[model samples]
Target: MSEQRLIELEIKIAYQEDLLQELNKIIAQQQHQILLLEKTCQLLHERMNSFRLENNDEGNEQPPHY
Candidate 1:
């Protein structure tokens, strides 16, 4: 292979390595964010269930007009 062609290939490889590292970092960050969102959703679901139960108990009470 010509010296110029070898140099070009090395440059391309370096750029690809950098790009892979950047993609890996982004994937890791996204995974962490997804986990946080999942936990938040679970907490919100629990709160909603509790609120519903409280509201149901209140709904059975007699009104002031009765």
Candidate 2:
């Protein structure tokens, strides 16, 4: 291949590699965010259950309408 053509090919390959790395990083960040959100939801659910149990012990009037 001509020298210019080889250089162009190298540049293209480098750009593609960089793009792939960026995409991978973004994917990792999104996964982390999803995991955090799931944990938050789980905690919220637990808290709600605990509050309900506590309220039940006192025989408080059930809140009108769920």
Q: After superposing candidate 2, which stretches have Cα over 4 Å from the reference?
A: 60-66
**What tens-digit string does per-residue lDDT give for candidate 1 at 8-49?**
999999999999999999999999999999999999999999
Top-TM-score candidate index: 1
Clashes of 2: 0
lDDT of 2 by residue, 1-66 (tens): 999999999999999999999999999999999999999999999999999998898677766685
CA lDDT scores, all candidates in order:
1.00, 0.96
* Candidate 1 C-alpha RMSD relative to the actual structure: 1.6
TM-score of each: 0.87, 0.74
